[model samples]
Target chain A: MSESETTTRAIQVPILTRVEGEGALHVRLRGNEIEQVQLKIYEPPRFFEALLRGKPMDDVADITSRICGICPIAYQMTSVQALESIQGIAIDPEVARLRRLMYCGEWIESHVLHIHLLHAPDFFDCDSAIELAKRFPNEVKRGLKLKQIGNRLLEILGGRAIHPVNLAIGGYYRLPRHEELAALVADFEWGLQNSVDAAKWLKGLTFPEFEAPYEFVALSCPDRYAIETGEIASSGHTSIAVEDYEKFFYEVHVPHSTALQARKKPHDSTYFVGPLARIQLNYHTLTPIAKQTAEAIGIAPPCRNPHKSILARAVETVFAFEEGLAILKSLTMPSRSRVPYEVRAGEGVSATEAPRGLIFHRYRVDGQGKVEFAKIVPPTSQNQAQIEADLRQLLPQLIACDDAKIALDCERLIRTYDPCISCSTHFLNLHIERV
Target chain B: MSRVIRRVVIGIGSAHGQDAIGWRIVECLGRLGIDDVACEFARTPLEILDRCEGIDSLHLVDACIGPESGRLHQLQWPDERIVALRWTSTHGIDVPGALQLATELGMLPTSVTIWVMECEGNLIEGAWSSAWTQRIETAANRIARTKARAVRGEIFYRCDRTSGL
Candidate 1:
């Protein structure tokens, strides 16, 4: 291929690396005027919802936890909440506190993993975290240490870090000992300070100037920053009941991708979820330290720039650590390990703010307490259409740049959302065709 | 001064089809009740770094898509002619890449050995193939015996070489 021939034609990245799962990106151009941008996800659907049919209500949490390795607690929490809601089981306040702590562990592990290992490298123009570590050893080490602490917290409360076996339909199989919870206090104190420092450190990184008008969606709680559970809240002040998710947001099948794209109805437009959405909508409810960190970093709400999501995630990590420490300090043994309940036929729906965004789980149980139908809406699928929309808005400005540069910029934009394609249906091949 | 070797056996695989061999082997080792060696299950290769930290020796077992079915291939780290092994998950980091990163980050174990069983038949979420059941059992017993020997101060290096079944 001659130099001019290469310069005039397309750019193709057969596979997208670093991001979780399989996907491809295709960009079609008509002499510098971009024709189309497609973020194609080709990972075969695992049929998780279909497979849940006939499974007992007791098995829902464990089964759904297999959806993603990174955020199993989110799956377990959502499924457990749905199952409990179906039976009209209101958990003990102590049990609720423990669940929130466990969820914080997940948020810490997942956010640290993405910020330091997965997404941070993109900012420094490195291939992987290993390469980034070579130059910034101290920062990488701090991140890994924070991650280890998160894993340890999970191990203590949930029995295992990957897929916790201790969670049950109503609550945990057994309540942890006071000593067990107290042992983590010292480490969590360090972790809280470390997270604050990490956020400040990430605030100093260079971010590309780009922002899209996004309809942010997340769970909003009246009391605290929502993580474990809340109603589906949108930036437009639309508060939809968890059971009413289908009425507000709908998933549509696109021919180019196996994962379904979700859009808010009535307007029928794409919306954003995940860190940026959560922080913007619930910044007031964040812990005092978290709010201070956000302010110190100049990350006040209404954050439109996707790249600043790294900062948002770090801020949330601080909140997780602070909340975890508070929960540990106020720990009390529950009167009962779990609320005893008889399972009856009913339908239940729940939505929790996962590390990425809002994860909704709806299940219809038969009279025999077996799952009749299951529907799960992960964050990545909800962000797919918005990702494409962002690319559409950003690509025209970069029309004169080389194809490779445009492709990398596109990848950086997608990673800003920390899209877990594994949880959704998974990328990404990049093809930029010029006609 | 003689250094004490802390050994860990990690079985890496999913419940998908023939891939369950790793979990099966780890279960078999657990049945042996070995007090000196630790046995763990890893859902993905990227978890290997966490499982291997501070360990003196490591043994990993997994099924692989290779030339021959129901056959075992043994590989040791630091070998110049190590065959490139690719993990099946596109979502998680591959084993070799993760190990390389671990080494760079000073997290890799002192010694590493991997046992890969060639997979056959459907690679779906189901039962293990009957053809490899006996092979898995034999490999598990061998690994157990190796752990017993190592506990007895037997320092064996490059003991099992790859051979066709």
Candidate 2:
């Protein structure tokens, strides 16, 4: 372990398994001192931005929804918001409530999937969720059942769970019956308790003692924990309008990744997003049950430990269930399902809190409603820099450990973000070079 | 009361590159206008599970990465020859993995078959390659013909005779 001793070792994990998309991790060390760590994203770029040009603006939601299967609603929500903004169409309050309900379903689905099927395996030292299930059968079944409830909610409201066809520029193609929404109440009531139990169960798991100083960003609404729409709020920064997303942040192409990494302007430093950031920035706005659960689990403000994100996701799942049930109980059918609007030449930008983090969509449409330009910034790309930075801080502490243990630790760190690499065209090739 | 047999055909693939082969086959089956068999397209294999309930028989078509590009591999479940069928997917559990899990949970149909076409091209979003187009037509026609026979109460396994595997 001496500085004078020459030690060179390389670890290449050809592919990182159990996460979405294709990615690899590379770490370089010079005689026990960490030289560099790069989370390489090699998923082929699909050129969704270029593909949107010349297509009708109405098709934007459907097209972008195909970007990520796990988080299709996020794409749909962001796209519809941007398109509606361009035409200045004020959606009905009832329609907005329905939208929020649908978003809550997505949060429940995505968060549970990540917590039980993806992230929990790393904690239990299992190869996959299948292995995890072997040890914890009842827990895995409960998680899957919770996920099914979320899917059923999406199916009821969005038409079909994956790439739902009901979403349009203004609102849904049709509204759900009062009875349909009422039936879901009982399920949500059960789900609320399940989510709470899941969080408490995760609280008992062991987490690495790690914390990093990084900027946490998420959408902040005035009333509640932002999911559907809100202003961009970062730790130690004033609220910025969604329309000024481009002005405040920009994506730069990195040599190692096909996806562009985002950085805040002026200072040009990396920031983190997703559940942990949302919980930290908007903890005060959580529902009563969710807030109490977080406090009981010992989650305080400004939580810097990324490993605790699983606990944060569990708390958010509880919030999603409570919020969805409340929306359904007070829901009233809108007079008209969608408002009519004429196409106008203008630019629009919208940011929504996706299950993983903040997702931004911008569009420029012609007078005929044809999309002239489009840009989408998924959360994983924004968190890529922060993922690497966290690894840099973590590697030095684990340098003395065996290569396999170090590799496992690196994978665990990456999984903490619960990155949807497919959405970002993104993490498991691990390479460590020691000299 | 006698329970009516419900049959479903699901084509699984993304809208990118040769992965669209499953979608193309489903689209072609739709044009054939078969009323008895329900046809759908899934972006990933995990979506196939929910669609399998109440189905007497299920057919899944998808693209595969293998040594022989453009060749079709049709696999029928309950076949002793195939051991531990594991499908590896980046998005979620792969088809074989899902099928095993579903069977364990007692959610799988009595009869299930999967048709996979080898695809060597990049899976980016774009038009289908010429080779994939021909394979799509062949797969769709075979699937449609099988559905037509099933509707007539005929028990026929088409791929068993012509399968190169």
Candidate 3:
């Protein structure tokens, strides 16, 4: 071997910017060959699952909601559905519609926040949202306004915007008054138009040209785009009930991450989730305008480019706004907020589409309505392995650049996933070592 | 009618440990029932933008990690150091970034002041001690009585040396 080829080098990014939670990235290179790529999640493990044991099943929704500030509704919704299943409780159709509306609020706020503040900056080559705001003040303001409307919906329906207290096992604790819902109609209409414009604007941004043959995974619903609940579907031609989530997908501990990485069972292959995956798998179920927007932007299903996930997120934002407005216009205060049920011992599992991706929750309850076992697989953990795999595929293109350039490129690609490292036991400061 | 200055006091923090100082101050302001001043609580710095509309004057209180546990620091609007100091956040933008975004969106009030209480060590999940409570009360009282002083663009520290609960 030549002396240059025998040398070792490292590239490290000590802090990753523009994504959620705490995490760092490390890459090792031997000559021109990539040795390893690790998406390190060093945040101390939060024992939420362990804490749920022995708690009342009724309290599970509120407790699990504490897991992610951005998508508390996702956690709350999945947890309640799981518990409700255990009790053999079927919600009133009106109650279910309102629940879907509330989830739309979460998707709108979470997706808009990510599209504008978190991911857009990378495309613009800006260091932070502040920089992006200076360059595109109008766009940023519109995004913020849309996010605020979503938060208002949550405040009205779920209680406060963060860790909303209104959710219960069977249904909501209190129904929103018609007047309160009526007041938001004007803003929702404006948001629906604005999101379409935002998606068009996002389509103009220059995204990196990289596509992977990823196995896209998301929830598929027969009646509509899956947000609140559905069967698990993947691009690899696999469909399974939510109860069979464990049989299809499994988590394994990796040394570099505090969060367990998820992989497809049997083959142990990495699969993608979140906006890109959802959009590809559920395109037919998207709202009319959302479909129109996606088509207008020149992106369709089978878009494997991770960088264009921003476009997918923008399209979803449009769908969320339209869906929310329809529900708001027709929803009335239900006679009873929740259906009553008797507690009995049983086990149940549920999957729902969070803004980021599909989140899974399962619980085993005793006859006393106490939790016997609890499991939560957040979207970020499910995407961690896929993220690392993307990085590995991306490194060859970046290897020719300097260490700093390579680090920046890697960070940009990882941000495409919009991984809530905090939700995943998250991180990224990048270091590339060459030997 | 004379111009009615719409003044608002915003406390930014979570529910855990000394971090709750911001929330505590707002609670104290509410309990004191200071007239003509509105009090608000912000879980994160970004939420500050949501409460800034149509207000003429804004006062923001938050906790910071500095040299001392109970020392109080104050800075006025346009103070450049406010952005340089430890005021950013990992969740998104920092307090200063939100302030800037608010300014850009034309939502910032004409007069602004920021008060940061410095605490040392890891901020655990609980309430503060009696001495800290007394300090928070004193801060609340001071904010109620005084408007933004002429100390514009200055950082002043009110480090209390006396130690008793």
Highest DockQ scorer: 3
Instruction: DockQ winner between 2 and 3, please give it.
Output: 3
DockQ (C-alpha based) per candidate is: 0.34, 0.24, 0.43
CAPRI band of model 2? acceptable
Number of the top candidate by TM-score? 3
lDDT score, candidate 3, position A260: 88
Predict model 1's lDDT versus the native. 0.83
The runs of at least 3 residues in candidate 2 whose Cα sits more than 4 Å from the true structure, single-residue gaps closed, are: A1-5, A423-427, B1-11, B14-42, B51-90, B103-165
- lDDT tens readout by residue for model 2, B1-165: 955767788988756677777888888877878766788888656667668877799988887676666677667875543334435564557676567656655667887877777767565665556766677788788877776676667856534333233
TM per candidate? 0.91, 0.85, 0.94
What are the per-candidate TM-scores when only chain A is compared?
0.96, 0.97, 0.98
Indicate the worst ten consecutive residues by lDDT in candidate 2 chain A. A420-429
Q: State the C-alpha RMSD over the true interface residues for candidate 1, after superposing those residues.
A: 3.5
* Candidate 3 CAPRI level: acceptable
Residues A1-435, model 2: lDDT tens digits? 564348567776665666787888888888767877888887788899999999998788889988887788999999999999999999999899999999999999999989987899888888877777777767877887898889888888888777777788888888877788889989999999999998888877888999998799999988988997889999958999998888889999999988899998888889999999999999999999999999988675868999999989999999999999899888897788898998899999999988889999999999899999999999999999999889989988898898888988888888899888784332367888877
lDDT (C-alpha) at residue A82 in model 2: 94
Instruction: Report the candidate with higher TM-score, 1 versus 2.
Output: 1
Instruction: Please identify which of the two predictions, 1 or 3, would achieve the higher lDDT against the true structure.
Output: 3
Docking class for model 1 is acceptable
